[model samples]
Target: MTDARRASGKNHYLWGDHCDGWRLIDGPDLSLREERIPPGCAETPHVHHVARQIFYVLAGELTIQLPGRTVVAAAGEAVEIAPGQPHLVRNVGNQDLRLLLVSSPDTAGDRHAAEPPGLP
Candidate 1:
């Protein structure tokens, strides 16, 4: 029998200054994680060589900076980031941002740090 997983009960890790990540499902072909970012925190811009990812908001707000566009996703909204697209994820709201990150073909060993154009 397969056991159910929850962020509070799963494998936990920290990343990107006060951010929390819980591994919900981890596999070679696909992976899912529950991530939380405190207000005003952001992750470094990066690109995946072969993994495509989706960020689905569970609560609060998400601000994503892409090549030339910015995407804001609230509760129940989602945004997809294709492979090779440079992007950064941030929490621009006063409250903490919570979201589910899903990646296809997994992202391990496939992520490359990038400097997005135009902004420092």
Candidate 2:
């Protein structure tokens, strides 16, 4: 039988100025995580070398910025990012933002920061 993992039973990591991430499934080919970002926190824009990723909003709202566009994803909505696309996710609400991040072929050591035009 395969083991089941829950957020309460998984390992947690802190990142991005008070954000928390729980690794629900960590594998070489794929990874699934539940992440929480407090209001006003934003991830720096970056690109993945090979992994494509999807962000599913569980609670609150997420402002996802791409190279030429920005999208707002609310609860139950998801956004897909192609590999090599420069993007970032930010919590622009007053409450905590909970989301699920799914990465294919893994994202470990595959990220590179990039400067988006007109963004500091």
Candidate 3:
């Protein structure tokens, strides 16, 4: 994850809003993606082929909506998603939502993400 205090460093993407830090922790076991999503921004709906995902809310609350149910996860809470399950996330707060998302099956890079119908 990019240091919040790092003033003169480059970040992951061009939101100018959310700060992100990504690293390959294990050689072939898992990966970590740290993100800070500004209010009103949301991640597109996607799926994994052979891996499971765990989303942990570090600071702010996040609204996670799967195909069947929608749940609000507060800070220090976590949610697990099994393989082939389609899911998506949204930041429904006024503050930046800091989150840690981990994915498995990193060795084979078996990821299958699809954009939602309304999204480009």
Candidate 4:
């Protein structure tokens, strides 16, 4: 959302909130990030600036909120999030939630970061 350049280390976050966790990857026109959801975690409604995001479940279960609907994505399954749509994610399983969240055009992760490094 800003013109400032951002960087991260290994296991870095492209961006996320309480209900979600993610790591940034390298690319152009497309930005890749590995996302995860911990057990008992969730988030409120949110948005992405431009990129269309897709969440592919690698492990555990994820409850995704869209419009007035909520869908469950199981392991090996995936869900797509369109640009400008308000959405959220929650972990509904007993185990840790794991997923690969790939966002194209690199604009899906423009949310402002609320936490600084080394925070709990």
What TM-score would candidate 3 get against the native? Answer: 0.75
Encode model 2's per-residue lDDT on 17-118: one tens digit a residue: 988888889999999998989999998878997999999999999998887778899999999999988888899999999999999988999999987623
Best by lDDT: 1
lDDT of 3 by residue, 1-120 (tens): 235453234434333335454442544678676667778878767777788878899988888777757878989999988887777778889888888878785614565576552421
CA RMSD (A), model 1: 4.0
Candidate 4 or 2, higher TM-score: 2
- Predicted structure 4, TM vs. truth: 0.70
Model 4's lDDT to the true fold? Answer: 0.67
Stretch of 10 with least lDDT, candidate 1: 1-10
Task: Give per-model TM-scores.
Answer: 0.90, 0.88, 0.75, 0.70
Candidate 1 Cα misplacement greater than 4 A, ranges: 1-10, 117-120
> Which sequence of candidate numbers ranks them by lDDT, best first?
1, 2, 3, 4
The 0-to-1 C-alpha lDDT of every candidate, in the order given, reads 0.89, 0.87, 0.70, 0.67
- The clash number for model 2 is 0
For model 3, the stretches where C-alpha displacement exceeds 4 angstroms are: 1-19, 24-26, 107-109, 115-120
Model 4: weakest 10-residue lDDT segment is 111-120
Worst 10 residues of 2 by lDDT: 1-10
3 or 4, greater by TM-score: 3
lDDT of 1 by residue, 10-46 (tens): 4878899988888889999999998989999999989
Predictions ranked by TM-score, top down? 1, 2, 3, 4
